[model samples]
Target: MARPRKPLLSRARIVAAAAALVDAEGLEAVSTRRLAAGLGVSGPSLYNHFRTKDEILEAVADAVSAQVDLSMFDESDARDWRTALHDWALSYRAALTDHPNIVPVLARGPGRRPAGLRVADAVFGAMVRAGWPPAQATYIGALMRYFITGSALGSFARGFVDDETAYDPADYPHLGQAHLLAERREKVDEGAFETGLRALLDGLALQYAAVVPDAHAAAGTER
Candidate 1:
């Protein structure tokens, strides 16, 4: 089939095509051949923009990262670490939810991608500026990511299948009516995210207070 006429192939086009392919199919489906076809270009043409498929995928991952709203940690709110981190986690989860296929790649680490580095810089800087010890702040960042990414994986509220007879009451008592909760599965998931975020932030707030009592005293903040 003859390729369509449009904008010439470029790095942006390659990365966008790759991301779309992954979204439509899966990560495994995003090959050079697949990306070329999606972009209406020859396979070799892609190399002009990216030498290897991995480079293209790195761009794709950064594209996904670009969607996350790290503005919460901007200069205006840098000192309010609790709110900033909480908002960032929510935004991160929402962005990953849009590209479920890309979440694993992002969770592994951002691999020097520009947009991903910005997110890391914003998050880590905010935590440290708010007086969390550097090591502790790093751990908190990892912890929030683990929670958000795990939440993105599956529904904690949607336990098991919705079939009433799927589970034998004799074998499992409490899980028998589990399907009933599936109807409100989304609410359950949202509630869990909020509850967990609050608990995690509250715990971290205590640690932050302990680490920099002088800062807290000077700021007169009760977070």
Candidate 2:
């Protein structure tokens, strides 16, 4: 007789296995049979947790989103909100780079998951704590998410392209200049992300800090 199977399969474990597969291979390798085989189980076993591969993929995306750590933003920092926000965005970019294959899936739509909401709340909460109005905080946080995620996906995808492609430098002189700078710098360096994040956060901080004239006056005197 065949040995009995372990009844330990759960949605979480299935998603984890799928994420691991995608991390090792690309997203194309994360089919139902592949996942089941990877877990040393039958295909039907996964059906017990997820109805379809899409569901499994969704779960995996959620699992990855859940992995982002936001503890550093929990306490009040003596640094300005611009510094704090830049750190948060940089940390988020680092986490995204660790799992490039799944970042595209995440970039598509994981917006409604609990983990996704928590990340939004954390960012908005930081802005709120820094004296931004509710509306401004929410808007800026969402904008920051779009900017950071889109930039990361674009940069990672471009890594597959050839380094020596010829282009008409005369037609797009600025882009050619940027290409030169890009070639000189490290490929994985996130200077663009950091620069953009700091500039936007600084603008937001300045706008919000204006509401506190007394604080601004005191800060000016110190400066």
Candidate whose lDDT is highest: 1
Give the alpha carbon lDDT tens digit for every residue of 48-134 in model 2: 888999877777777767777776568655645566666677777777777778787778745677777788788788767766678
For all predicted structures, in order, the TM-scores are 0.89, 0.76
Alpha-carbon RMSD of each model: 3.2, 4.3
Question: What residue runs in model 1 are displaced by over 4 Å at the alpha carbon?
Answer: 1-4, 217-223
Clashing residue pairs in candidate 1 (N, C-alpha, C atoms within 3 angstroms): none
What residue runs in model 2 are displaced by over 4 Å at the alpha carbon? 1-7, 75-79, 108-110, 156-189, 211-223
lDDT of 1: 0.81
Model 2 quality (TM-score): 0.76
How accurate locally is residue 40 in candidate 2, as Cα lDDT from 0 to 100?
85
